[model samples]
Target: ELLLTTYAFCYHFQSDDPLIKLVEDYKWIDFFDFHWRLGIDGLSLGPILLTGLITTLATLVAWPVTRDSRLFHFFMLAMYSGQIGSFSSRDLLLFFIIWEYQWNLIIHT
Candidate 1:
């Protein structure tokens, strides 16, 4: 994950324009619009890289965990993904969803 984050950082640095990797919309209600969009740019890449670093270090330091270690790691990775999503999401709804999920995961853990 850290390696991937580093690669993304390098890729973003090499690119002159913001990268919008994905854009998809899911309509569940007529009144609301939910777009699942993701991108990486100068502003967002920093947080993504930081999150990747911190999560990697956390996983390493949590090596001694014995009780429900698998579940713990699962949640950790989920939270990490949420963090990444929140950072990269280009849509307001997507960001909100990811943010709420991260908070819920943190509360549960």
Candidate 2:
């Protein structure tokens, strides 16, 4: 599933519309007068692909392991979610929140 998503992402990416905003809202919350925002662009492409590829590979590599495999995969997925969120986030607060979540997942894992 991730591999397909990654391939689609790469295949559909357009240089002309590089900077794509996923979210923008004034009612989300104002932190220091900043609203929540999420976006992706050319600069973020590398990180997004890298994250997807690495996580997919890691999941495949660990698939046969029997020791606490469910927990491991859960954390791995959570970490990936946080990473993707951070990479695509345009708002500083959202990025920081995801960053902290990833950090915690790493520590616990």
Candidate 3:
């Protein structure tokens, strides 16, 4: 996770035009636009970096799990994905969905 964040930071800064937007439009429904749009910008970078740092630290601190280790790690990964998704989502619906998913994971855990 840290390595990925570092790579993203480097890629974000090194480019002359450091705007990376990935868009995958899937109109799965008839009325609404279901676009899986993600991007990294100056504002988004801060939270992404912070989340990476915190999650790395949390993983290190929670290394000595006695039982259900796989489940614990799975939750961690799910939460991390939700956070990163929420931070990088370019669409409002995507953002809301990720946010809700993160909260739901937290609640269930």
Candidate 4:
């Protein structure tokens, strides 16, 4: 929902902007992407929004899943922590750490 809505909004907003149209209409820039019709339409804002929302809701939902409240909480917290790290990471190193953390939880769980 967020992705599609943001993409639609951005595309429509830039549809009338001269600068956006200039880049889209350029020959050289358009040549390499000739076969590829899709391009960044300034809708990257959607992912930014969706990532945050997913991270937040996932954390909230996972909290109640672990009721043993001792060792079980560790995996829940660990999983949530990894999810947050995954969402915030632009760097490969941190993302890998988070990815591994989740797998670690799955194995232990």
Candidate 5:
């Protein structure tokens, strides 16, 4: 799934352009007047791709491990999701939330 998604993103990615905004909504936040925003650019693309590739490879490599495998994969995928979220997030609060979520997943995993 990740590989295919990454491939699609790469196919559509344009390095010379600024970030592409995927979402923007002020209605989701009522306090501090912040909007929920998400975007991706060349600056963030590297980390996003790296995170996806590494997580996918790690999952493949760890496939033979049978000790609490489900839990391990769950946390791993959760961490990856948080990382992707952080990379794409255009809002400070959302980035921080994802950062903390990734940290917590790391601790629990």
Candidate 6:
């Protein structure tokens, strides 16, 4: 994403020709198909953020009750990594992998 942002800015600032207009024409929405547009939206971003926050807060709240707070910390960290992975995943299979990554955390907790 950093590289992409850098490249985008490079094109926007360094080029002024009309032909350059064609290079950065794609919208973020274009990444998804028409069918996906029905399901994915700004509204969905809110819930994903909310759910991620809830999981993080729950883990923090459970710190004292967990038998070994150290182990809980490890598993919670794993979960946090997974949630971030899922948040950024564009491929369905990659998203599934991210979702599954939290299973062990569930079992351990």
Which pairs clash (backbone N, Cα, C closer than 3 Å) in model 6?
A: none
lDDT of 5 by residue, 1-109 (tens): 4777577576776777775834454545677776777778778878987888888889999999899988888888788888888998888888888899889877865
Q: Please, what's the RMSD in Å of model 4?
A: 11.7
Cα lDDT of candidate 2 equals 0.77
Estimate the overall C-alpha local distance difference test score of candidate 1.
Answer: 0.79
Q: What is the Cα-based lDDT of residue 63 in candidate 5?
A: 91
TM-scores for all candidates: the values are 0.80, 0.79, 0.83, 0.39, 0.83, 0.45
Off by over 4 Å in 3: 12-31
Minimal lDDT window, size 10, model 2: 21-30
Measured with C-alpha atoms, the lDDT of residue 55 in candidate 6 is: 66
Give the lowest summed-lDDT range of ten residues in model 3: 21-30
Misplaced by over 4 Å in model 2 are 7-12, 21-26, 30-34
Tell me the TM-score of model 6: 0.45
The models' CA-based lDDT, in order, is 0.79, 0.77, 0.81, 0.50, 0.79, 0.51
Cα lDDT tens digits, model 2, 1-109, are: 4777566676776757746734355546544676667767778878888888899889998889898988888888888888888988887887898899889888876
TM-score pick, better of 2 and 6: 2
- Pitting candidate 1 against candidate 4, the one with the higher TM-score is 1
Which 10 successive residues of model 4 have the least lDDT summed? 19-28
How good is model 5 by TM-score? 0.83
lDDT of 3: 0.81
Residue-wise lDDT of candidate 6 within 1-109, one digit each (tens)? 2244335345543343322221212133455532111122233344545556676678768867757778767766677667655654555655676678777667766
| Model 6: per-residue Cα lDDT at residue 65 | 70
Question: Candidate 3 residues 13-85, lDDT tens each?
Answer: 6445656643344554456757777777767778988999999999999999979999988998999999999
Per-residue lDDT tens digits for candidate 4, residues 29-103, read 444442211222334334545654665566566677655766665654565556544644544544676689778
> Which is superior by lDDT, 2 or 4?
2
Instruction: Name the regions of candidate 1 deviating beyond 4 angstroms.
Output: 11-15, 18-33
RMSD of each: 2.8, 2.7, 2.4, 11.7, 2.1, 10.9
